[model samples]
Target chain A: MKLHFSTTHEDHRIALLAALAISIYIIESAFPSPLPGIKPGLANVITLFTFLCYGWKIALQVSLLRVIISSLLLGTFLSPTFLLSLSGSLLSLGILMLVHSLFYPHYLRQYQPSAIGYAILASVSHISGQFIVAWYFFIPHPELFKLLPILMTFAVILGIVSGIITQHLINKLCSTHNK
Target chain B: MFTIGNILFKTTDFLILLSVSSLIIWLYSIFWSTDTLYGQAETLQVQYYNQVAIDYPLDTDRIIKVEGSLGSSIIEIKQGKARFIHSSCRNQFCVFHGWLNIVGDSTACLPNRVSIRLKGTLNPYDAIAGSQ
Candidate 1:
């Protein structure tokens, strides 16, 4: 017996976005790191953009695909790098979905998380999730806590930067799509 | 709409940004405080010529003298920070290495065969705990 799979429009969109993000991830990894284990994570802009435009379901799919595919391409699959990436993606996605469910409903629409809000939350959580997993499962050094302030500083700054980029993209593209 | 320069976002987005910024400040206060790390990450371990390293307390400012293969090396601990003040080594690389305050920080005077390492619970015990 043979099994067949059907693809939907949503699947195609997720794949396309994920491919874009994977390309960004691979390119970013090739650059020299000023500090070990720190990257700007520019690829996250794609995930944030998808979440803002399409909603959490598609965003989650895009994010997971990006992590899996990027790790496979970079030869980090099942390694510590892959685990850290997976944990960060899962955590950021979990929070994104949680926030979306709470606000994207009936009367809560007025205070809906804008692209900037979602981007900041996702990026900040992304770094922090990687930090905690590194501390617990891999390093476990208490001095690692010292780097947290610096790391979070980078995270917050990068979050704001990415948040602005995501907001700008939403302004340009989302408006065009809603019509 | 909340406008930052040219980019525009909702009031809620600005609020989220405000709260997250404050969170970074809070983390800075907790983990990056110089006052806390000064006394906590103590002791500088100095060694030479395959001899077991001796732990020198970083709390009291003092000059430590260690005998290396070539000549004596001087290490100074001031204000909970250690550095090689003078070394018999020709290159003077160890003295130029500057301050070593953080745990696991190390520098060596290769010609004199002398080395100094910052020792603390922050690294060794944690490594054992993690690998086990």
Candidate 2:
């Protein structure tokens, strides 16, 4: 017996991924951040996974849905934090697509980028977008620029961690599906 | 296939990413790090609510008091280093900043509207932290 849903398979898959991403986002937000603007951004793993498994379009849909739905759930809709998150997500997605198209095939005739490569590129662009938005719209201070190094360091660490996790999960899912 | 935990981990990809990240960090440090303090600060300038209260040489060991919006702040210059000793502000951020010996180091008691800035040959970077 198979379960029946109103939505198509593609819609169901996106909805499931969005739910997972939103759950991760909410859970991450519950934890206390060591610094004001620092976060693990673990939810990005889902986006990375979707991008690798499906394609850029599904990944983009999942990411946007996750951010908007999660922000609404967290009661941060239309707030400064929401704006920052939206900008970061959009910028990161753009960078991820660019890197995917440009480097995915050239380096080794591979179809797509390695998980770590995509993670690092997306994370760096995400943090940069957020920082630029925060500096321009919120703080507007040179002191804010000083946080770049610290933020980038955090981005690198988180990128590696999430990339490894996404790779492992994809391998597991793929192997099980093949079986 | 180079596999780590059943996943095809590419050595070339990892190396490329590592090099790129390191290069970025290196460039950032070169451009932003304040390790090379621009010429020695010859004097200290105290400002209260945007008004210049006093300008004094760092060669002397002395304390200067300046009144601000909230109350008075005591700035002490000793051993070519200057610091805020006391302020009426609840959070003593300025006082806690320890000392300012570099050309562009500064401390501000925002609540009290008092700021201490070093005066000398201006440096490209005012301050650099994290890359020790």
* Chain A (alone) TM-scores for all candidate structures: 0.90, 0.89
* Candidate 2 displacement at residue A152 in angstroms: 0.2
The TM-score that candidate 1 achieves is 0.67
Candidate 2 docking class: acceptable
Fraction of native Cα-Cα interface contacts (under 8 Å, chains A and B) also present in model 1: 0.84
In order, what fnat does every candidate score?
0.84, 0.33
Off by over 4 Å in 2: A1-6, A104-108, A175-179, B27-32, B35-101, B104-119, B122-132
Candidate 2 residue-wise lDDT, A1-179, digit = tens: 99985878999889999999999999999999989888889899998888878888999999999989999999999899999999899898998887666655555445455787678877888999998899999999866666787788788888878888888877766442211
Scored against the native two-chain complex, candidate 1 gets a DockQ of 0.46
Across A63-116, the per-residue lDDT of candidate 1 in tens digits comes to 989999898899999999999999998898888888877886778877886766
Error of 1 at B38 (Å): 1.7
Looking at candidate 1 chain A, the ten consecutive residues that score lowest on lDDT are A170-179
Lowest summed lDDT across 10 adjacent residues in model 2 chain B is found at: B123-132
Q: In terms of DockQ, which candidate is strongest? A: 1
